[model samples]
Target chain A: MKNKAALIFGYNDYALEIAKNIQDEYSHIYIFSLHSEEDILKNKSDFEIKSFDLSDKWDYISENIDLENSIAFSVLEDIAENIFLTISLRSSFETLNIIALSNNKETADKLLMAGANKVIPLVQTTAEMISEMMEKPIVKEVFHKILFESGELKISQVKINSSNSYLGKTLSEIDWKVKYGVIVLALVLEDMNSEFIYSSKIKNHIISEGDIFIIVGYETDIIEFEKIIGSRINVHWSHWSR
Target chain B: MGFFSRLIVNLAYFINTSDAYQRKKRFFYDILENNRYPYKKYFDIFMMTLIFLSVAILIAEVKSEVDENIEFFNTYVISIIFFIEYILRFWISSSVTELIINRSEHAAMLGRKFSLWRAILKIIKVKLNFVFSIRAIIDLLAVLPFFHELRLLRLFVLFRVFKLFRYTTSFQTFVSVLSTKKFEFLILLMFSSIVISVSSVLIYVMEANNPNSPINTMFEAIYWSIVTISTVGYGDITPYTSEGRVVAMFVITAGIAVLAFTTSIVVSALTEKLDEIREIKTIDDIRKLKSFYLICGYENVAQEVAQKLKDSPIGIIVLDEDSKRIENAKKDGLVALNYDPGNMRSYKKIGIDLSTQVKAVLCLRESDVENVYTTLTIRSINKDVNIISLLMDDGNRKKLNFAGVNEILYPKGLVGIISKELIGRPVAFEVIHALRNDYYGVNIEEILVDNRMIENTMYVSELNNSRYRVILLGIYKKNKNRFFFNPLDSTILESGDYLLVIGNSVFIKEFEKYLHKKIRT
Candidate 1:
């Protein structure tokens, strides 16, 4: 069995936050700080700290961590350095999941082009937007639970297999919420384009094999949903971590 | 005291103390002096029309035989309106009776004998000050046309054109712009006057002896000097002598220098006032909006909110103390003002009826203190205005809440939470982000269940999801102020409850139409 690990670059507030939040999810979490040895020594953190430069070939990362079953985050504050780190990691390990944080839309595009699996634009989340979302009581509660007290509320992507009974059926024909206790947020199609489950484009779309459904529910409910739908978790990670 | 004096004093006290009199005075004050009064615009337009009509009649009277009806309308009707307006302005400018009563009361408090003559003198002094003011003098001259029988006083009727200065804001802004450069103008005036006087004397001295010179008198010389310096050069007053021609050359050169100086001064003054004038125009535009979202700062957060609301029916007005940010917002096609968000005067300047006109106030300043101050200022102006403030620090959340902010948003905390989620469940984070940023053309929107829905006794199951293609996320029951996530199909929707759903933008529009159709059916 392969062990799950998380590789986080940079040692800033966001890096520390990701490390602390996912400490239990990974068997071993490594924080690669780009700072000098003295600076890293002065600022001690809970995660294992290893210094890495932009020019490094990332050979040590491949040797130390199980790349196939691991996740990598390029969250350096500098946009250029972050993009370079994403590129270096992508070159070393083709199957590793790499998530990069970007300050704006331009950097987000550049990071994606730099072979980051996903680019989370910091501009997407703003104070005004949070306030606007908070205006809706239901959205507020859902986000509050998801962020602060995510108790057994697991968000998983499930891929439909060929033998599923619901194949060739449209989304509107099924009352998934009432029958499965799982909320399907979106559908990732064969072309890798995602559509909201309730979107009009997908209302008449046939649920064919290889289509992935991003769902949110309790672990038990998600497992039951996957079993009933004749599908499996989409991610390669063997064990789902809370 | 004499009988007349005692009677006047008693009348002053009565007028000063009467509530009805004060109310009437205030009513007239709003019509005449208050620019913000709802009816003031109509009153100004009416007065402007009358002024234009009278001036037109004056010009027509100069060359043509006027009709009796037209003469009567212009001379009597227009004159009476102007007289009434002048009297109303004089009445509102100061309260002599209030002053008298207060002075006498103060004398009594000091245990000194009240001097009636001294009080009368003080009252006259105050009234005299108003009488001599430029506005009051213009009003007096505008009324002087009533005495058209005195042809000399007829010329004073032209002063009605100057009254346009009071009615139009653009004219007022121009006057204010010039007023700001008073010191520069004074220096220009001094320099030009010296040049004019010296040039006039020199021309007079040189040309008075020549037979062909028009500069025979000091007055004619001064006129020529002014005409030459102003670059008018009528040529009716040409210098005949060589000495006078040489002096004319010097005068023309001085004219160019003076012209350049004057041009530069006015240009700089106008440039300085351009931003203020634009801000005023923006404020005026905001005041005309029936409803608008007032975004306090033109930062990234405000820009994002504004962009999201751009297609909405509600107007958006952005305010920032930074001129560059305001310029950026303006370039983005938003009504932006370079006005301080924390200043109470900025709210008053926009003249928004906050409770009725402002849909919501978003305080998106980077500093928590500024956001808090803005919230307090808005709350002080209108207690019912919806305020949403950004909390830069978690510790300032309570402070912002205490400042009467309806909603407090901590973006850093949100970012931390989102980043954490990205680590644990990256696909779920992407879905949420896509829904928010409209990446996949999907959106989460809220629909209000009004009385129509409640009257129809609608249930969650009644919404034909297949028809509208929207998924019901939850129901926000307004009565309980609680949210039911994935509510049961049997749950009945009530009035004031909000239906939260996720769908494509087009689908949401259709879903809303479907809900409304059910109400109608």
Candidate 2:
């Protein structure tokens, strides 16, 4: 398994913010771009770069690239190019979960068919963002601030070790709601490769040995995963001993 | 043996071949033992044939000593056939019961009661029962063997024509259409009321004094109204008066209008709602939806904001004129709209106020004035609603405050700012264009949060600490009417907090992956 990321197609500071979000985890990620106002040298590093000519369609993903670990996005001015690139990437790497920047419903549809794992059209997403802010501002604010920017919220991956209470514990057993302000996204099990620990796929997710549980919470909330359940591993695959 | 017994046996076997045969066998043995019981359907066939054959033999005996010879040589062959038929029926039932016994035994540990209750209670055991569906109580009537002899009584089957009720798929379809378009149906019903009332009054006034008029009483006028509206003009009740004729014409027209209205509503609703269904089921592999970003209205500004947020992996929920925006969002892999956003109820329908769950609300409505109003409504109920409104005028930016807007943007102004940068700082635009281009040297971006540098005390110190090469800058925060460019080192870091740094464009997005923990180890 490797690391991956997507550049949300935007020509402003917003694009830079999203890109920086994913740089810390991967060794070197790919950027499907040739230019930007916000310089990446200032705040982020360790990324492999590839330029896509919307006019020429020159984006080719390298082979042996675990598509599940690769992210692609377009923030350029051309809506049609963004859609075309997403589709082309999808055809070559069908399972390469695409995160595309769409302009409207039509483009979004094209992206989905092109195998974009996620499509974020500007108007549609903005409307939802506003509606959510209006509906529940505080909790959303805290979550947004923590997960996005301007806060101390960190979501980490911790492997279950021999000593913690979570050694044989199911997700439901932790009672995360009352104990700590944390949400368990997926329990990573070495054997449960068939199970990607989807947030919604909540059945038959047996967390056994050599499995990793991917959880999201504040750095403080991680004490539960570290102290109560399992010893935190470096998450470097080389150190993952059975 | 008896009429009722025959019916009981016929119904039992007709519905349940296995259980019914078992019951019949028990009854058959009882009857042989001289236990008094009524007749069964099979008994009728058996007894009648027995009597007929016996009578034929007796006649033969009388005619030329033929019956005497036959009776002296023959065993009970007819009886033997009847007995064999009975035994086969019992054997078939026993074998069937054996299957259920084995299945239930294996499933015993599951503690589920295994029963083919549906098969046992199945009204129609075969295609022949479909005949029963069209005609009421066919099996019940045919049970009475006497009906076979009484030809006049058999004519009563003409009344069984009512069983068409079961075969009415069209009528059932119509009913479903009516229920689905219940609100539209109610409107049509209102129109029917007008027709009925108007016709009832007109008929009473026109025919009350006429001795020859068939529309004499209120009930008769009501019945005529129903027939006229239904377009079923059964001429038994004719309106002889001019006034009644006028009302009848209006009723006919009104009926036609209401029918058309109902049809239109139903057709339109089906097309509109079904399209929504098709779009919603597109996305399959979504991982988690922390919060839904509900855009208040569908405007240009909302569209731009939605694109920017979604590029960053934040989920978007759209509420606008077209409810289909929600479905489109879902297929795009964001927690899209499940309901409307403006109407508080519709907002709840879309998961707007579902506790502290939604990530953020970016209010990019068409009009800042309208956004202020909408934001006000949202903020009143959910005080924590993170409202980011689109403002056209700088003045509206202040107005949005009273409504509790968390962030405000002007699409034109933002565009103007970007364009100004294009002119004022050419290198800035080049950097952006270069970073956006993958071929150039790695572009720079700043991640607000990352795991490795969580305890990096100062912005500069944090950048230095990261193993991945990057830069650092002062963080930005709006504190008391001004944007704080950078704060002091004493700004102790919380478990979940922000950072200000500079890095490669691709790596910034990579940073969010670290935050989302999307990396594979």
State which candidate has the highest TM-score: 1
Clash pairs of candidate 1?
A: none
Chain A TM-score compared with the true chain A, each model in order: 0.78, 0.57
Q: What ranges in model 2 sit over 4 Å off?
A: A1-242, B1-178, B181-289, B322-340, B415-420, B429-467, B474-497, B505-521
Interface RMSD after interface superposition, model 1? 3.1
Q: Residue B429: error of model 2 in Å?
A: 4.4
- Candidate 1 vs. truth: CA RMSD? 4.0
Best by DockQ: 1
lDDT of 1 by residue, A1-242 (tens): 34568888988767776777777777788888888487577766767788899885676876777777788888898888999898888787778888788867788888878888766665556743644553454665665665457566666778888887899898878878888877788877756554345334566788998888888776788899988775655443222111
